[model samples]
Target: MSAPLLQVNGLVKRFGGLVAVNGVDFSVAQGEIVGLLGPNGSGKTTVINLISGALPPTAGSVALQGQALTGLPAFRVARAGVARTFQLVRVLGSMDCVENVQAGLAFGTQNLPQRASRAQALKLLERVGMADFAHTTASELTYINQKRLELARALALRPRLLLLDEWLSGLNPSELVDGIALLRSLREEGITMLMVEHVMEAIRALCDRCVIMNAGSRIADGPPAAALAEPAVVRAYLGDDDA
Candidate 1:
């Protein structure tokens, strides 16, 4: 097998007395969608932030294709082909959907010309199923549409790796189905993803593997079926009657 697309080794993050993420190690292969699963405060988000350079790790390293990214700032990480969406969707509220995506295209890995950026942004919006809302101001979008807009903006980065934080959190049944379909399409295009998601059905449908965490440490790393079935995972996340 080829080397993993992303490698994180002995990753650690501490905020004062709190060890938010303990020595986590995982690797994601090219084009694979890996689920980062855990209950609340399991440090899943902290792990994501550390990998993406939103927060520097207290110790250890993160590398992509053997290139170190551990201590780089967030913009440096983005320029290195890592793009992420937040748990709480973030967009330029005053800008129209298309313009919001344009900002990404302008400052993303590859800087595009203004006209080309505009056109490409529209295509990205189309990819996320938000083309019809291109002219709408971001503040006008509903919660799900805001999520789609965030996806479009992230895609504008033309990333090799995508980090999605609870992208499926608030969808109704229909929207959830559509969201799943959208993610599958991205996977088909060979986009690698490490998703921090609570939706079990989405995890089962989309993740080729899962890494489960608890109390800031990794507890299980394997296929979702086997990992989710682990007694420790059940006790930590799925709720054990014995506890």
Candidate 2:
């Protein structure tokens, strides 16, 4: 069999005396949507940071398609075909929707020219259901629209691996439905994703497999139902009595 598209081996992170992530290991295959699930402070986001080059790992390694990505700066990682969205929506605020995505296109791996970048940015905005808001300043958008805008920017990178850090949180039921559908569509378009999310509904709907973390370490990895049902996962989310 061919190798996985992304390989993370023995990943570790430290902040002073705190071990935010400990020897966490997982992989994302080509054209797969894998959910990274855990309770608050379970080190899910830390793992994302480690992989995305937002934070250098204290140990272990990250490789993309056999190319070592460990120790690269975040920009280098992006140029290497990895893009990510933050848990807190990040946008150019000063720039309008189209320009925000255009920024991504310009800096992304493709680095399209001015006219082409704008054209591609608009298409991406439309894909994320923000066509009408193409000229709207990012700061003026509602929370959900900002999320959409962030996603559009990430797509501008034309990444092989997309890391979504709670990109679907804070949505109502209706918005959640739309969010899940949008992600499913992206998966169909062949974007491999590793998402850190607490939304069980989206996890079950979008993930082919899940890697569950607890207190900075991986406790389970398997299909959503099977992984989430693991005794250790259950205990991590619920106390011993509940487990």
Candidate 3:
């Protein structure tokens, strides 16, 4: 809708004659949260990779604010105002929380030393409620803290579109609530987000719209309540598993 801030059309990805994502299409608009849901191997991560430019699609089109992004590299994509986070929370194990976030900031900058200063890094940590953990070693932090660190890092890019993969995987109920609030605040700040998640409550609470993928293709697309109630969606991704 409204000429999506980021658009993926007929996206296809293959590996050794095996198709991972098959003609999938989706879009994320300015200030909206869209959920991408599917079971394991349903092509959620593959689709995110195509959008984030970590992997190229075999045939399809990706557009950012209506401009073609088909051939851009990952950094180029980030420069275009799209940021992605890994499902496993990629942080520097040796670096402190602040430093980990600073590395991410430097990524979208035009010019910066390979390393960032502690002050700059702390500022990012502050944004994610991690300022107190500024000096905490990544490996020393708990699982939820690491996820917050990942969010701080991603925010360093000041992206218009944020791609998140399984961001809620290991969070406790309270952590999920806090993380969802952070995402909502980002959306209010006009950041568009597309997330691939299995947490039903998070999806229902956070997303304005939903896209359900089955067999590498879209099977349902609509408001969360509507999509969740669809017959195909129940059978494929949200059925008895939710009940």
Instruction: Give Cα-based local distance difference scores for all models.
Output: 0.93, 0.94, 0.85
TM-score quality measure for candidate 2: 0.98
Model 2 root-mean-square deviation: 0.8
| Residue-by-residue lDDT tens digits, candidate 3, 1-243 | 267788889999889888888898887778889999877888889888888888988999999998778868999999889898898788898988877877787787645554545566677788778888988999999988888898888888888899999988888888888888988888888898999998989998999999988878888888999987888887885567664
Worst 10 residues of 3 by lDDT: 109-118
**Order of quality (lDDT):** 2, 1, 3
Between prediction 1 and prediction 3, the one with superior TM-score is: 1
TM-score of each: 0.98, 0.98, 0.92
Q: After aligning candidate 2 to the native by TM-score, how far in Å is the CA of 150 from where it should be? A: 0.3
lDDT digits (tens) for residues 140-227 of candidate 2: 9999999999999999999999999999999999999999999999988889999999899999999999999999999999999999
Overall local distance difference test of candidate 2: 0.94
Return the candidate ranking by TM-score, descending: 2, 1, 3
Clashing pairs in 3: none
- Top-TM-score candidate index: 2
